[model samples]
Target: MKLRVFNIIKNTKVEGPGNRYCIWVQGCSRHCRGCQAVHTWSHKGGELYDVEVILDDIFNQKDKIEGVTFLGGEPFEQAEALGIIAQKVKEKGLSVLCFTGGKLEELRENQINKKLLDNTDLLIDGKFIEKLTDYSRPWCGSSNQRYHFLTDRYNEEIFTKYKNKVEVNISKNGQIFMNGMGNFDEILRKVDLMGIK
Candidate 1:
């Protein structure tokens, strides 16, 4: 299977616990207002990569990464493709974290989405509600979103340490990127003022 990928961050500390390989898949049907990744909402453009190839890359850095994270354009939208990758990640003894705009109950009704969920170690679910934006929770965009620990790989208590935190990285080429669930616009504004890229 091939996944329509928007971008990939080889090493990151903010997407989930520890160091992670983050994959932002292409296409999201839910165009939530004030979404930080609005560029990812469209399904039209993105590169496609075979699932095995992606798995191979992740495995290569298995020693350096705790797990892989599946982010939008709504990971559940490409559930089948990500499901395959998640399963293989498990076989390699790595965990999976998926961020989605869909509710858990709604996802369970679909077989493909269920498979993706089953393979996930943790899930951050719900649409990004700008009005309810929260900065106190770890890995949640808003107060309405939730963290579902589907597997026992991660302890809930660990989240308390990450509350209200954000990670910013400057690439070798001088481009800046940030990973966090809160205050996206504020962070962007700061980045813009810095004129880093």
Candidate 2:
């Protein structure tokens, strides 16, 4: 199966617990307000890669990364393909953390999400509400967003163990990419003022 992908970071610390291989899948129907990844909202916008290719990349970094993260364009949008990758990674003792704009209740109703949900170690749900924005928690930016510890791999301890942070990745194309939770625009503004670009 093929998955539309916006970008993939082979290893990153701020996205989830420890070092993680993060996949930002392409296409989000829910255009949540103040979404940082507006570029990923188009269905036809990103490159497509075979599921096997993504899985191979994850495995290649297995020894270095603690797990893999599926964030998007809503991850649930490409649930089936991600489910396959999620399950395979779990078998290798790699944890899975997924982010979604949809509620877990609604997602559970769809049979397509079973494997992905079942294997997910941590699932962050709820759309980002700009007005309710609060970065007190890890990863998520809104007070409304909730974290579900789907498995024992992670839990309430994350509140103390991790903090919201961002990583600046200068991609192979020389594009400045930022990931994680924070005031992205302000950060970019500072970067611009610094004459870094």
TM-score, model 1 to reference? 0.92
Clashing pairs in 2: none
Expressed as tens digits, the lDDT of each residue in 1-197 for candidate 2 is: 99999999999999999999999999999999889899999999999999999999899999999999999999999999999999999999999999999999999999999989999999999999999999999999999999999988887989999999999877678789899889998998998898875
Error of 2 at 13 (Å): 0.5
Error of 1 at 128 (Å): 0.5
RMSD of each: 1.7, 1.0
lDDT of 1 by residue, 36-136 (tens): 89888889878999998998899999999999999979898889989999998988888999998989999999887877888999988899888997767
Instruction: Please identify model 1 stretches exceeding 4 Å from their true place.
Output: 192-197
Best by TM-score: 2
Using all chains and alpha carbons, the TM-scores for the candidates as numbered come to 0.92, 0.97
